[model samples]
Structure formats: C-alpha cells, structure tokens
Target chain A: MAEPGREIPKPTPETQHFWDGCKQGELLLQTCKSCDHTYFPPRPFCPDCGHREVAVVKATGRARLFSYIINHLPTPGFEVPFAIAVVELDEGPRMMANILECEQTPEALVLDMPLEVTFQPVSDDISLPQFKPASQSTGSGSA
Target chain B: MGQKTVAIVGAAETTELGKIPHMSQIQLHADAALNALADAGLTIKDIDGVATAAHNPVELAHYLGITPTWADGTSVGGCSFMLHVRHAMAAIEAGLCTTVLITHGESGRSWVGRHGPSLFPSELQMQFERPFGVSRPPNMFTIPVLRYMKDHDLSVETLAMVSVIQREWAAKNPRASFKDPITVDDVLNSKMIAYPFRLLMCCLVTDGGGALILTKADRAKDFPTKPVYILGSGESVESPMISQMADFTSSRAFKVSGTKAFETSGISHADVDHLMIYDAFAHLPIYGLEDLGFVKPGEAGDFIAERNTAPGGTLPLNTNGGGLSYMHSGMYGMYALQEGVRQMRGIAPAQVEGAEISVVHGVGGMFSASGTIVLTNSE
Candidate 1:
C-alpha cells in the first residue's frame, strides 16, 4: 500500500517555511506582526489586514475535529474507508487532515473531539502533519 | 429592470445525449449550435452574440462560421451557462448584440479531445485540500453535508428521497439515461461514495451538450419556436474553495442569486409552476429550497420527503429528471436551462400541464458559485 502522504506539496517561496517547520517536528503558522492575526497556508501578507509585517510562530498543536467524511473512494497511497477530517485549530482557523490511530468509523470518530498534531515523514525531504486522538500519549513525536 | 424585453427563441440539445464516443467535445458544441439555429429557423448569420462554458467562444464562433459582436466565456463551473443566459440578456438590452446564441458541451465520459483546467501543486486546492487525502468531488463536497444534516436534523433517508423523486421524473422522459424508478432503499444501499452520499445520490457521468438562442422580445414572433421570456436573472460568486463557504448549512451565493432574481422578476414563489435546482448532488436542491425562500431553513428535507416535489405535486421540480437521472454532461446547468425552455414552450416530454412560469437555478462548483434564471411563456 502506498503511504498516506503520497502527494507532497511543492513548497513555494510563501509556503516554504511551513514545510520546513514540519520537518523539524514543529507546527509553524504565520501571524501578522501589525495586527496579531494568525493564518495558515502561509502567505507573506496578512489576509485580514494585508500587512506585510508578519511573524512565524509555533502553534499549540491543539485542535478539535469539526467535521469529516468517511471516504470509500480509493486514493493514491490510501485505503478505503479513511476519514477525511476538517480540524478547527485552537488558533481559530480550519485545515484538512487525515485522522490516524483510530478506527475509521462513525462510532469512533466523533465530532468536536480533541486531536493533536503528529508529523509523519512521507519522504526524506518532507514530513506531513497528521492528527490522532489526543488521549494517546506515546509516539507523539516525529514518526 | 426591464426584464421582459429578452426572450429565448431557440433551444436544443446535442443530436445524441448520454453517450457519443464518436464526437469530440468541440464537435458537440458545433452540433448543438446547429440544432438550435435550425430550431429558430435562422442561419448562423443571424447570431450577433455568442456565449459558452468550458469551450472558448472564439473557437465556437470560428467552428460555427459566425462573427459575433459580443462574446462571453464565463467558465464558472456547471452554472456557467446560467450566467451566460443572464449576460446575454444584459448584452441584448444594452444594444451590444441583437441575437445571442449560448452553447455548452463536454465529453466527460469519453474524454475525447478534452483539455480542461489543471490544479497544479502550487494552486490553493493542491496546497491545502489535496494533502488531506480529499480525493474528488464526493470527498470535497462532504465538508458541508455532515454539518447541514446535523443542523437540519435530517436523516439519511430524507436525503436519499431526493434521488427517488428525481428518478420518478426520469421515468417519464425517454431520453433520460436512467429511467427505471428507484426506491429510497435502493439509494441508501448503493455503494457509498462519501458519507451522506451514495452512488445514487450523486449525478451521472454522461457526454452531451445543449444550446440556447436569445433575441429581443420585439423579434420574438420571427422565430419558428414560441418564445420563453426572460423574466429575471441573477448571478454571484462566494469563494473558489468550498471550505471558505460562508455557512455550511446554506449557500450564500444561492441565496443572493435567487433573491436578486426574485426581486428583479417581481414574482412570488407561489406563482412558480415549475422549478429546477441544479442537482449535481442530492443535497443541492435541499440547499436551494431554503436559500431561494421556497422553504424555511431546516424544513426542505421534510418538504421533499413528504412528496411535495414528486410527480403530480403542487410544485413540479426537475421535470426532466435532473442530473441525478436525466443526464450530467459535466456542466449540468445547460441541461437545466434547456428543460426550462422546453417547459415554457409547452413541449417537454414530462410536461407540466399549464406551466406558465419556470425558475431554473444552478451551482457552479461545490457551492462555490451560483446563478438563477426566471422564465415565463407570457410576455
């Protein structure tokens, strides 16, 4: 089976720092230095105020499952019945990720459940940020 | 606001719908254009304006051997054609063009000479969405379905009824790709493409195209076919990304477009005898109903589940079976617009008796964009 992170996104000048942070086991996000506004899929300017002054800050790596779908369709490097979840970050934005370490079923994956970030190295050059139930303590570091 | 001056004088689909492996995507556009021209009893020379979705107007005009003073290539996804109709109305009113022809064609199933937009790794969709293993439409669309269901207290069975009701309409049309009636159980049991969306709840992958001709109402009598007057039309865009939608329970684009059309047309929902909400997926109509003010929020599920939109119901919906059972040529808006013109002309196969006014609405992406057109047989 292909690994879950089959397609590694090519980092552009704007988003290179985000990928670099993942490789170092840190979840880095951009915040506007002028407005103190944080955002994801990093850009140089603040999306809210269009300020050029921005800073990269380490995230709390805490989030909750906002919504998701159990996809039966086969995707590259993934099996069927996988959960495609939307996680609401503690910093107030949402991002998509695949949930791991839990059975991919409705009974187990509840909405608004606590989740924490776990980086999985899909390639020697890239490590993907994935999520799992926050209750699991071990293997919390880079996998 | 002078909406009654524009009318649809010509409308037709490709020579063969559902599947046409022999014809390329561009060829389908040419065929549908010729058929519409013939239906209007006019030659290509009569067209002064042209619009299309997916295919380029420059190529379409060149292929059809016509020169248009005004051309529109609004590629907003499936609802692109609806916007074309609205733009054609404005162009005609502003004297930019007199007679307009709008065409749509796609070889979704065959992939013959298909050259579509690509989502590169640097694109926002690839950078954020694709990384999450969100495979395709069924996967991406699910971002809203679960939340809508929870907000509305809608059961899975209520959503499946959308397919069952559309199939009921499909059974009456001979050209429908899937005519056999299917029960809600049949829909629920179909292989799940995504949670809350079974195979039946999803639209079909077929190859086809449709065309429309518009002219000033003063010239309506010159056409061979009866005119379907443009009562009102509206179009709007939310966000290109589905995740950025303002509300998961409702489509703001749908609400804005539908409200604008209704206000411009000055027609109440009670007067609409027929309706078509783009049914790319079963949940679309449910969203359309609430957003259009035809039903209250969290009530469209029960409204459809109680047989209000089924055949012989007070308000006929998707009288042509819709994308669920009729045909989805990738961009399904053209088919919906064709059915609207057909009903106004009083010649649809599943014709709604004494149908005077029809409202056709379409969604471009997964609630990313929307357009609404209101039509009437009377001047």
Candidate 2:
C-alpha cells in the first residue's frame, strides 16, 4: 500500500479562484466592492459588508511571522520538527502555513520577522502556499 | 441578577475516568447521565429537555428512552457544555422546559465506537491550515503562545510552573490521572510535543464523561442533593480558524463571554471564592485569567507564577486539578462544570474553605469559542 500523503484542499466555487491564482503563481485576495475590505480563504460575498459583489485582486505575498510552533511529531508528507506558523499578511489578514528555508527553532524563527510567500505544488490542481524568510530586496512579486 | 432563577441539582462524572475501553463514546454519555440522574434522585422520564455536544441530542435522548420537549446539540467544541448550561437556564426561565440534562462524553484515548475523522475537502481549515501540516490540538492550540510570550515577556519557566502547581492539586484528588509532584524543571525537561509545550504542559488524553441536571431554582430543593444555583452565564464565538484570532495574546471570545457573565451576575470579582478555567494547555489558564478580567493583560503569567491559583492561595482556581493535571476527555467543559458544582456544594476533594461562589470558564476549539458560568450556593 502507498503511504498516506498530506491533505490536499479541494476548492469550492467560492475558493476556486484563490486556488487557481496559486497555481498560476499569483496570490489572490478578495476586496469588497463597496467597502474596499480585503479578506482571505475567499467567499463570494464580503465578510465585512456582506456585499455579494467583490473583486479579486493580486496580493503582494508579503507577511510577518505572527506566531508559530515547531511540531516535533511526524506528520504525513511533512518533515519532523517543522515550523507550523501563523503569518500575518501585509494586507492585514492572517493564515496558517509552514515556515520554510529557516531553522525550526525559537531563536532562529523570531516573532514579527518579515516573510515572503512561496508555492509548492502538492497535486496537479493545488499549489500550497507556504512562507520563508524574506530577502533583502523589497516589493518582489509572488513566487 | 436580582433573584436566582435556575439551579443545578445533580452533577456526576462517569463511574470511571482516564480509560474505559469497554465503553463506547455514547456509552460514556449514558453512564454519566444515569449517574447524574441517580444523584438527583430522578430518572430519564423526568427530563423534559436534553442538551449535549459531539453527539446528536436526539440520539442521546432516544437512547436513554426520553422523549424531550426541547433538545439542543450545540457542538462548538470543548466548551459546548457551558453554553448548554447557559441555554438551559434561559429555557427553564421561559417555560420551554422544566428540567434539562446536559451531557459530555468522549473516548479520546480508547476511541471506542467513535466516528473516524470527517474530511471536508473544501472546508476553510482543510484548504488553508491542514495542507500546511497543521493537525491536532497541540500544534494548533499552542500556536499563539509564542506571540503571547513575546508580547508579555513571559518566560518558559513560568509556563512550566502552571503544570507544576496543578499537579500539586492533582496529588490531593484521588481520581486524578497523575498524582506525583512535579517541579518546573521536571515540566521543562518533559517530552516536547510541540515547541514551548512539553507533555506535562498539555492536557491528558483520557476517556471519560460527565452530566449535569438543571431546573428552576424553586424546584431545585426537591432533588436528593444540594442545589447549586446558577447566578450568571455567558457564551460567545470568534473566528473558526485559530490563525485569524483577533489577537494572539488574548481571546476575544473569552473577554466577551466573561464580561457578559460578570455583568449579568452583578457580582464583583471578589465574590468569586472558587474558580475553574479550562486548561487544555498550560497557556490557556493564563489567557483565561487575563481575558476573563481576573487580572490585567500580561499579568496572568506573573499572577499564576506567584502561586495565586495554587492550593492555599487567595484564589482557589481549578480546584479539581484542571485539564492539565486532571482528566480531559476531549470536550472538558462538562468536567469543569462538575468541579464548580462540587465546590459550590462544599464537597470537592480539594474543597476551598468558605467558598461561596464559583466561576467556571471554558474555551472551545482553538480559541474558536468560549462559555462562562457562575454558580453560587447562596440564594
């Protein structure tokens, strides 16, 4: 029998665009047409104003390390002692991801450290959005 | 606030806690229900209303041969029972039901007759969080502690102290899963399940259940046991995703629920002689203390470290050893409520001397929801 793999998200109508954007290497966010409120894990309507009309906009893919834990338990398709983090996007929304390209230790993964989004395709349809320490350069587009 | 309206006449845990491989999940619920009924000197036929979490109220009511007029299956998370108690009070007052039975049971360790994990592929958590390797409560619930520590200058040693003190309380309780005294060094040196959270700092994964019976205050005296009156209760919810919590250092749900309960109860903090803050993890009580307004933000760590919540301290918090040192059967709110009722009745294993009022606060999910209940022995 094949070993179990990490969970892959199946996109609904509301979140298909977000997943599609990830596949194309563009991070997408939803902005309320009436209130200009941008949110994540997309839905058709705006969470703030409940406005059905909304626009899909590309995100800068920049974020900050808000909080995290270095999980020692071996999860499927994940290396043991990996950093499972909650990163606050520069756009003011937060999301969970694995912190990569950095030491999975408290001393190395400082809180509020600048980070940038990176995509790793887990399946043909899903490109999981993850994070790593930001480079010195500013305003680079999504990976 | 003016007068007592509802009272809990009976509260009991399953005949055995920690582990019961023979009993399935629903069987744990039934055992607790039967025990609580026996405690109150009533049978299933007397229950007009039913409420539970993790299982449908309809199944529980029917299995117990009850045809309840009212039923609620509010499964927000671990704190669902606290919300049920709050709702039962309102239901009894509004004449929706004369007597309500609230139950909680989980075969967390045994996993007997429990359903396998449900897969919702398109769910928000599955899409965003799970794919990134965030699974189970330890990783998800402990995610916010690092930020809380950074913002408040809390040391890891203080976090370890939470487990050490709670273990001291556990030593006094004969039923506690762990009774040996442990030191902060012991906690820090314990197996690291997740960063900043050692095995000792996490709650026990046990199989157990508990039930409570509530009715109008006027009819409470007819029960076989002493009645613990419901003075006030509150409940609220926040973002389902732990990552989207408004602030990592505090829970908005806890603040909202605690404030509402305190306001409705019309009782000052000083009036609370005993307290139970659901401690699924060590950092939870810290968050519970500060968010519940018992202490200012950034002070709960210091307050707990100073042993204010320890045995013989000014505030007897988690007199039942809490989830950290006591038994945590997945949905732990029922056990917390049971401890509150015990303290109010002055029969707790580690009873607080001269205890008059007790506040039981609980959190569901990964800071996803909260419920607060205040019980008083006085009318």
Q: What is the interface RMSD of each candidate, in Å?
A: 1.3, 0.8
Write candidate 2's Cα lDDT for B1-379 as tens digits.
6357999998999999998999998899999999999999998999999999888788899889989889998888899999999999999999999999998878999999887431112268887888878888898899999999999999999999899999999998999999999999999998999998899999999999999999999988888887899998889999778888889999999999999999989999988899899999999999999998989999998899899999989988888888987899888899999999999898999999879899999999889999999999886
Give the CAPRI rating of model 2: high
**What lDDT score is found at residue B318 in candidate 1?**
96
* Candidate 2 Cα errors over 4 Å, as ranges: A1-4, A139-143, B116-122
Tell me how each candidate scores on DockQ against the true complex. Answer: 0.60, 0.84
Candidate 2, number of clashes: 0
TM-score of each: 0.94, 0.97
* Per-residue accuracy of model 1 over B224-279 as CA lDDT, tens digit each: 88889999988999866666576889999999999999999989999899999999
Superposed by TM-score, candidate 2 places the C-alpha of residue B141 at a distance from the truth, in angstroms, of 0.4
DockQ, 0 to 1 scale, candidate 2: 0.84
Off by over 4 Å in 1: A1-5, A32-37, A49-55, A136-143, B117-122
The sequence of per-residue lDDT tens digits that candidate 1 reaches over residues A1-143 is 23854676777888889989998999988899999999876889998899999999998788887778899888887888888887777887777788888899988888777889888787776777888888656322322
